[model samples]
Target: MASREGSLSVVIPAFNEAGNIGDLVIETIDAVPASLLREIVVVDDCSDDGTEDVLKRLSVTIPALRYVRHGARAGQSAALRTGVRTATAPLIATMDGDGQNDPRDILKLLAALEAPSGETVVLAGGVRTQRR
Candidate 1:
């Protein structure tokens, strides 16, 4: 379990995913426990499909939601790098803004990391049964 209320920050790299980004963020917030969640950082890659507008609206209602928009249209890797850099939580979990990745898996991965298996576990990754 996270030692504090805000230990996990989910970094989502989004580009023109305005249609599903809100749903993804809302689903993540609902699926992850508040005690372990710190924030959801969505780094927009200069999406022209009103992604910034949606993020702006969501951020106002969700204090944990942080929005970072790039002035130019950077690729996903750059957006991911930006998000990871901007995140404040000690632990960072990453997922797609299109809702392909399951937010619920975050808890399971965290459990594996904190299991104290008498070995030095640096990271845990979840493989989806059906890769979409």
Candidate 2:
């Protein structure tokens, strides 16, 4: 695991993903080392399928888990923007809320950022072949 002075904030944007949100949150917490992660922010875009309830319940179990809900149904970009705005960490990581993203990838990105390279790399990302 890579160590950093600041923690990483994970931002996830969700719509009506009640079925998948719980497992995603748990997996994300398990995948990220506690020392490296600050918090997991899930932005709910006015999901009607009890997504908020799931997040609230998960928050009780996971101290780092928090969520914000939009009053009206907003687009994915809006939800992501809200999550980023609410994040407290200096470094931010984003993922899909459909549970298709692998949390291990967040660690790889963090490692790359922490790596000592002469050239400055602002960001690193990749596409997963598998789809939900």
Among all windows of ten consecutive residues in candidate 1, which has the lowest summed lDDT?
113-122
Residue 24 lDDT, candidate 2, scale 0-100: 90
In terms of lDDT, model 1 sits at 0.91
Per-residue lDDT of candidate 2, residues 1-132 (tens digit): 454644789999999999999999999989988888899999999999999999999998799998899999879999999999999987899999998999988978876765486777778777888876
| C-alpha lDDT values of all predictions | 0.91, 0.89
Say which candidate scores most in TM-score. 1
Alpha-carbon deviation at 70 in model 2, angstroms = 0.4
Off by over 4 Å in 2: none
- In model 2, the worst 10-residue window by lDDT is 1-10
C-alpha lDDT of residue 79 in model 1: 95
Q: What TM-score would each prediction reach against the true structure?
A: 0.93, 0.92
